[model samples]
Target: MIVYILNVIIMALGLYCLIAKRHIIKKIIGMVLIEYSMNLFLILIGYRINGLAPILLPEMNRVQFSQYGVDPLPQALVLTSIVIGLGTLALMAAYAMKLYEKYRTFDMSEIRRLRG
Candidate 1:
């Protein structure tokens, strides 16, 4: 419950940053926060209280394992997502550096402001 609330709060803050901030780096940070929050939510949704791992041993009853075991799919999905997110963040950071080199500023508004 508390974890869910914290995830929501973090997501909200990230959204706020993405919507209200002008800096490219800040927007990237916001995107990271949102991604992390979503990953956490997925993991939490698949979690069971007092649950054991989904691994099956030869001695364990299949029915009992099915009933008490935790879901492993979400965990796998989150791991993939984290890897993708890291690659995306690295790409975004590289773009930011390129943008800074061309524009001499990190502020998105200032870099793209209308010239009149």
Candidate 2:
């Protein structure tokens, strides 16, 4: 229950950062925060009570395996998500550098080219 609330708070903060901040760098940080919060939420969703690793021991029966093991899917998804996030972060950082180079300031409102 507490974990859920924490996740919500994290997500809200990210959204606020994106909406309230006028700095491109801060918006990028908010994007990262949103990604992290989603990953955390995914991990918590996959959590099992008294869960053990999903390793199949030689002596363990199917019944025991089902009862003791945690779901491996979310863990795998989180790992993939982390890698993707790193790539995205790198991309965002590169974009931020370019924006800084062109605009000479981090403020979003001053970047007139972005407006449609």
Candidate 3:
């Protein structure tokens, strides 16, 4: 329950930053926070009580398969998500720099050029 509450709080904070913050860099930080929250939530969901490592050996038999096992799917998914987030963050940072260079300011309202 605590984990769930924390996840919700993190999500709320990210949403608030996204909606209330005026700086593009702040919005990017909010997006990163949101992504981290989602990843953490996913990891929490996959957590098991007394779970063992999901490793296989050539000499191992199926008789004791239940005793030494762990979920690898979530780990793989998390890794992929992290890679995607890194790419997104890189792109966002690049765009922010370009925007700053063009507008000479980081204030979102002052940088508005399409007020149509």
Q: How many residue pairs clash in each candidate?
A: 0, 0, 0
Q: Any residue pairs clashing in model 1, and if so which?
A: none
Give a tens-digit lDDT track for model 3, residues 1-116.
89889897998899999999999989998999999999988887777678655677777776665654656788789989999999999999999999888889889889777453
Best model number under lDDT: 1
For residue 95, give model 1's deviation from the true position in Å.
0.7
Q: Write the per-residue lDDT of candidate 1 for residues 25-111, one digit (tens) a residue.
A: 899999999999999999889989888787888899888888889889999989999999999999999999998987799988778
lDDT at residue 18 of model 2 (Cα atoms): 93
What TM-score against the true fold does each predicted structure earn?
Answer: 0.86, 0.88, 0.85
lDDT of 2: 0.90
Query: Could you tell which candidate, 1 or 3, scores higher by TM-score?
Result: 1
Ranked by lDDT, top first: 1, 2, 3
* lDDT values, one for every candidate: 0.92, 0.90, 0.85
Error of 2 at 71 (Å): 1.0
Q: Name the top TM-score candidate.
A: 2
For model 3, the stretches where C-alpha displacement exceeds 4 angstroms are 57-68
Q: What TM-score would candidate 1 get against the native?
A: 0.86
Minimal lDDT window, size 10, model 1: 107-116
lDDT, residue 93, candidate 1: 96
